[model samples]
Each structure stands twice: as C-alpha cells, then as structure tokens.
Target chain A: MTPVGAVATIGRLCRITRVTWLSELLEPGRMVSTAIQVGSQVFLTACLWTALYAHTEVSAGLQEHQAVGYAVLAVLASRLRPLSRDMAPDSFYRHMREGTILYWFLRPLPPHRYHLVRALGDQAHGLLWVLAGYGLCTTAGVVPLPDGRWTLPAFLVSMFLGQVIVYQLSLILDLLCFWTVANSNALHVSHFVQSLLSGAFAPLWFFPGWFTTANSFLPFQSTLHIPLSIYVGRIPVNRVPREVAVQAVWCLLLWLITRTLWKRAESRVAVQGG
Target chain B: MAGGTALRRSVYRLRLSWKLTSLNVRARLEYRVEFALGILAGILWQASVMVFATVLISRFPGLGGWSSGGVLLIASIRLLSHAVYGVLFANVNRLHAIVQEGKLEAFLLRPLPVYRQVVLHQFHINTFGDLAVAVTLFSLALRRLALEWTPFKIVFLCAAVVGGALIEAAVQTALSCAALRSPTATADWTGWLDHTLSTFGNYPLAILPGAVSGLLTFVLPVAFIAYLPAAVLTGTYEGTLVPREIALASPCAGVVLFLAARRLWNWNMRRYEGIGG
Candidate 1:
C-alpha cells in the first residue's frame, strides 16, 4: 500500500470506530449503568484507602492525600485499558464454528490494525469516565493534587506508553489462539496474573520486597504502577525520565514481539473442512 | 400422590445431574494441561484479593476495629459464597448467549425441566479450586480469631456458608430472569453487581459511608452474605449499621431471597419468547 493510501485507511477506520463507540455511549441505559458502576468502584477504593491510612503508623511513605490520589487515579486509569476478547475461549470457539474469522483475512487492511483502532475506540468511553471521576473526586475533596510540578505531563506521556504496552501484551495473547483450539481458561488466568502484576489492584510498594524486586525484571510493573506512581509523586521528578524510559522500552519490546507473533499466527490458521 | 411424585422426580433429577456433572469433569480432565492451568489460574485469581487484604492489614491493624483474623474470615466467607454460587448459579452467565443465539430451543426440547437443564448445563470445575482455597483460609482464620466454639457457633458457621451461597445464587437468578425481559439490560448490570458485592464485601461494612452501608445491608443485602455474618461470629456485631438481630437472621434472609428469586424467575420465564425464536 502507498503511504497516502495507508493514511486514508487509518483515518477511515478511526472514524468508523469512533462513531460506533459514540453510539454506545449515547445509549441512555448503558450510560446510567456505567456511571453507577464506576461511581461505586471509585467510592469503594476511597473507603479502602481511608481505612488503610487511618490505622497505619507509617503512611507507606505517602501522605494521606497522595495515597488517596493514587487510589482514585489508579481505578480511573484502569478503565482506559482493555485487552482483546478474541483470546477468550468462547469467542474463539464461536469464530471457528461460524467461520467468522475468514472475514478478517478478506479485509483490505490487516486484522490486527483494525483491532487496534477498535481498542482505541473502546477506550473513548473509559476516557470520559476518567474525566468525570477526576472532576468528582476533586470537587468532593476526596483526592489531592500531586506534589511535583512535572507530574501531570510525565504521567500523560507514561500512561500513553503504558496503554500501548498493555495492548501489545493482549495482542500476543490473542495470537496464541493460533496454537490452541481452546484458550478460555488461558485468558482468565492471564488476566488475573496481569492485573495483579500490573499493580492495578494495589500499589506494588505495599507488596513485599522480594515480590517487587522480582516484578522489576518483568514488564507488568511499568504499565499501570509506574504511571500511577508518577502521578501520585511516589516516584521523584528527577526519576520521572527513567521511569518513562522503562515504559517506552517495554512498549517497543512488546510491539516487536506482537508483530512477529502475528506473522506466525497468520501462517498457522488451519482452515478445516469445506 | 402428588407430593410423592414430586419427591421422586426431584431424586431422579439430582441423580442425573450428578452423573452429568461427573461426565463433564471427566471431559475437562482429558485436556489435563488446560484443566490444571484453569484451576491454577483460579487459585491465583482468588489469591490476589487475599494478598491485597494481607498488605492492607499489615499496614493497618484492621478496619472497624476488627482484627486481621476477623477481616480474613469475612474474605474467606465471601470466597466460599462465590464458590457455591459458581457451582449452583453461574449457568446464569451463559443465559445471555443462550438467549442471544436462540439456544433456548435446545433446553426447551429436552425431556427435563428447562430450569434444571439450564442450571446443570455445565458445572464450573474451576470453582473447586476456589473452594479449596476458601476452606483452607477459613480454617486459618478460625484458628487465628480463637473464638470460643460452642455447638451452636459451629452450627451457625455451617448455616452461614449455606446461607451466603443462597443469597448470591438468588441475586444471580433474579438477574438472569430479568435478562429474559430485556436482553441488553441485565447482563452488564449483573456483572457490575457481582463485582461490587465481592470487592466491597471484603472490607468492614462499618467503613462504608452510612448511605452505602445501608444500601448494601437493606437493599442489596450483600452485607448478609459475608460481613454481617462474620461480624456476628466474631462478636463484632455492634459495629454494623443494622441491628445485631438482623445480622443473626442472615440465614432466614437467604431463604427468603432464594424463594423470591424463584418466584420472579418462574413468572418471567413463563412469559419468555426466545429473542430470535
């Protein structure tokens, strides 16, 4: 494909994806349900953090406000990242049974790129939720601003890289469907491991030293933990560049891995009986 | 004659369900590696929250003046409830797909009752993993809390486990029944409700703001499933927003909710015409 043609395809895909997401958001019942769901989660996390801070002698090296900020921001940020449902065993089984996946091969553009665009669109609603949560938390005085000057800019950049890394990781899992006929259990197991290792459930700092030390060797910590830690000023401003660099490195590594896997996965698509 | 026939039918269905469940487990075991991975994954998944609870309790003594053991008891009970719910009620999750694809015809064509067919469609083999962990943790918490054990407390403990499971199954059944009326409405909301109950149910209900605590207790009744029951056993019943007598009546509440859910399910089910049927 020519450069201009590729650009046009991307633009069209983005528009289609965005329109679908917009319609989904506009659905009144779904909108209300999401608000209630997200509101409860934020409120629950705030309650949990408040209790933790209240009884502890040491505030886990964070001020009460900083800890609250991290708790709420982490929950809000979790919304923006979604892994592919293709790896889920049930979906793969249906696609295979119905031969729906053949449609992907017939598409003009690669299916992976199409999926990436859709993933971005999926996050559109989550982005709105995050904005609303930030407003609510701020107005309610439930969370405080970060201590450092560079926190906001650094957090934004790092978070983008974090999402990319998460997307690449999920794509790699999805590509595993080429090997295994049933991967539903694998998806469930992987999701649980990734969410915990990513520190979405709790800050990695609270974990024992050996766990955090082992986590440093892996890429999961760089996804949600590093970005949120930066946002909450847990990582010093001087160390901001280092943390962001770590995320970028993980993103690039996962990107390369996903690309290689996609090639292999395409070749291995065993077409069964007519 | 009518009551005897009903009893006989129930016995037959229970025996058939046991056989079918065994066969399902055997089929899953054929893929040994995958089966093992699923169980391991489930254990790890359930363990995550326990680990989180550990970290929190380590930092703070306890929420609502309950000890670490008290908190762990609550967590363990919740897991046990979830395990039972998975075994007995998780088929409701599949109701969305069954209705969406008009697969209800399969159940309708079966010789068995539609509810029985749907409920026993697939036994959740993964929940055994959760059950094992919950039992182990509950034992540990029991040892740690060191409550004076009477025959009554032991019996209440048994009742709480069964009651907690009933409450969860009731909620899930009601949601599934509601899904029959509006396909898109209940599935997402059911998931949200489950997540809210399990996650928020971990902490002491006393820590939640008054309105939220009341909502959990009186409206959703998630409090009865784990928190209030645990509070009663731990002698910390005073901390709960609701009365101690209400906490003690959790078993009765569970029975009442279960019957209500059944009535709702039967009423809605009678009116259900398959989406694309």
Candidate 2:
C-alpha cells in the first residue's frame, strides 16, 4: 500500500475505534461494574502491600513506597488489556465459528492489518482505564511518583515498547485459532502464565534470583516488570536504555513471526462454513 | 411409602446424571488435544496459586501474623472446595453464553431439570487436576501445622470443604439469575467474583482493611468459604472480624447462606425472560 493509502486505512480504523468507544459508552452497567472492579482491585492491592510491609522495612531490595507503587502500578497496567474482546464477535475463533471470517478475506483491507487496527483500538481503550486508575492512585497517594526528572518520559517510552511486545504476543495467540478449536481453558492457562511471568501479579524482585534470571531470558518480564521497575526506580535510569532495547528486539522478532503466521493462515484457509 | 418412592426416584435421577456426565467426558475425549490441555490448565492454575503463595511465605516472615502453615491450610481448603464447585456448579460462569446460544430453550424442553442439564453441560476435565493439587497441598499443610487433630476436627474438616463449595455455588447461582435477562452485564459480575475469589480467597482477609474484611465476610461470604473455617480449626481467631463462636460455625453458616441464596435464585429465576436469539 502507498503511504497515503496507509494513512487513509488508519483513519478509517480510528473511526471504527470510536465506534468501540460508543459501544462501551452504550453499556453503562458494564462501565460501572468495571469502575467498581478496578477501584476495589487497587484498594485491595494497596492494603495487601501495606500489610506485607508492616514488619520489614525492606525485602528484596525494595522499600515500602517503591514496592507498593510497583504493585499498584501492576494492577493498573493489567487493565491495559481489553477484558471481553476475546468473547466478542471480532475475535478470530468467534468469526470462524459464525462464518463471518469470509468477509475479512473478501474486503479490500487485509486481515493482518485489520487485526492490528482492532488491537490498537483495544489498547487505546485499555489505556484510558490505566490512565484513570493511575490518576486515582497518584492523587490518593496510594502510589508514589518516581524521583528522577527523566523517569516518566523513559517509563512511557519503555511502556510503549512493552505493550507492542504484548500485542505481538496476543496476535500470535489469536492466530492459533486457525488450526485449533476454542480451547478457552488453554487460553486461560496461557493468560496465567503471562501474568505470573510478566510481573503483573507481583514484582519480579520478590521472586528468587534464579527465577528472575530464567524470566530475563523470556519476553514476559519486559512486558510489565522492566517498565514498572524503571518507574519505581528499581532499574536505574542508566540501565533504562538497555532494558528498552531488549523490549524492542522482542517486538521486532514477534512482529516478524506473526507476519509470517498471517501469511500462512491466509494461504491455508479454505471454505469452511459451506 | 411416598417417601420411599421419592427416594427411589431421586436415586434414579442421580444414576442418570452419572451416565450423562460420563458421556459428556467421552465426547470431550474425541478432541484429544483439547481434553489434555483442559486438564493441564486446571493443574497449572492450581499450581500457580501455590507458587505465588509459597514464594510469599518464603519472603515474608508471616502474612498478617498467620503462620505459613495457617495460610497454606486456608489456600488448600479454598482450592479443594473450588475444585468441588467446578465439578458440581461451575456452569454458572457459562450461563450467559448458553442463553446467548439458545441452549437454555433446548434445556427447558428437556425432561431433566434445566439446572442439572446446565451443570452437566461440560466435562470439566480440569477439576481432576485441581483436585489433585489441592489434596496434595492440604496434606502438606496438615503435616506442617502445629495444631493437634482430633476425630471431631477431622470430621469438621470434611464438612468444611463441602460447605465451602456450597457457598461459592450459591454466590454464582444467585448471580446467574440476572444472566437469563441481561447476560452481558451478568458475565462481568461473575467474572469479577471469580477474580476476587482467586486473589483474596488464598490469603487471610485480615491483611485487608477492616471494612474490606467485613465486606468479604458478611456481604460476600468469601471468608466463610475457607478462612473462617480454617481459623476455627487452628484457633487462630486473632484478626477475624467475627466472633469466635461465629467463626467456629462457619461451615454451618455456609449451609444456611447457600439455602437462602437458592431461595433468592428461584425467586429471580421465575422472572427470567430469555434472550434466545
């Protein structure tokens, strides 16, 4: 596609993204439910971390504020993924089952680009939640601000790269539906693995040395841990570039693989609903 | 004579359900890979919980003053009962999808009870995996705890597991009442309830603020599932928001609360307007 055509496609996708917002705004009940869930989640997390720190001043090289901030940030960062999209009609498995997938192949837009567009839209919505939660936490003094001048900017850049890696990972996950059935349980198991390994559940610093070492070799830690650690000053500003570079490498590698899978998936497909 | 006939009829129904469940498992077995992965998923979920808890225990001196063994006991009991709930009543989570797919209409036409059909809808191959990890952890907890075990305590332990499962079933069943009409919204609440249970159910509620602890205990009855009962077993009632006598009777309270929730479900179920499209 030409650069101008690419811009036009992105613009149309952005409009569709607006419709997603409209759809969510249309459901006040779900919105309220989400607010309550996120509120209670942050509250409970802060309480747990506070309780855990009551005895020791520091454990695993993290102070009370840093640990609490990291845990609370993890809670907010977790909201970065749209919760119900997997069950929505746009999902690959759902589309395949409902026979609407043929439209993707028929449309002028390519399926791979469509997938990325929808994922970007979802991340936009999820980022709104994260922003709201972060604002609440910061204002309430539940999470502390980082000390360095460059911390916020560096964290933002690193977080962007991390989310790219995360999206690439999930793109591969959705593409798995081309060969397999629903497998919701397997999906859930993978989610658990990501949460545990990605430091969404707890900071990797709390984990033993060997576990963190093993995690460093995988793409998971860069997703949540590295960025949050930077925000909380666990990973010093001097080391920020190194961590972000690792994340960018993971992103490039995953992007290449998913692109290959998309090619294979399109070529392998035949009429199914007939 | 009437009671005997009723008993015989119930027995027959139970036997038929067993046959149906086995057939369901057989059908799932047709997808060999999904079946194996389903079981693996269950084991990994349970194992992940243990891993998180064990790592915390190793790092922290004690969680909110409860011994590591005490916390483990609560976690094991909660997971064991959760496995039981998965076996018997986890279909509540899927009720929305079932309604959306028009399965409920078919269920209503069947001779068997709609609830039973829904409960038996899936094989729940993962429950076997959850049960295995739960039992192993419970055994390890029992060995590590400093408390002495009596015959009464042992019996109460068994009752506690069943009661805990009942409480969770009741909560989800009551939530499912709304699923008949507005399934999309109901799914969020059930999902949140599951999230709450998985995150908070393992730890002692005392770690939380007093009001939050009360919310889990009285408003939601999550504490009744395992923490209160486990507290009674070990006599570690220090931070429990409720009285000693109340905690001791948690299992019994679970029974009462579940019965009340059932009554609520039936009342709401009557108003169910299916959205079978």
Best by DockQ: 2
Write the residue-wise lDDT of candidate 1 on A209-270 in tens digits. Answer: 88999999889888788888888778887998888888888888888898898888788776
lDDT of 2 by residue, B117-157 (tens): 88989868989989998998898788778778899898988
True contacts kept of each: 0.59, 0.49
TM-score of model 1 vs. true structure: 0.93
Residue A81's lDDT within candidate 2 is: 71
C-alpha positional error of residue A13 in candidate 1 after TM-score superposition, expressed in Å: 2.0
Per-model chain B TM-scores are: 0.92, 0.96
Give interface RMSD, per candidate: 2.8, 1.7
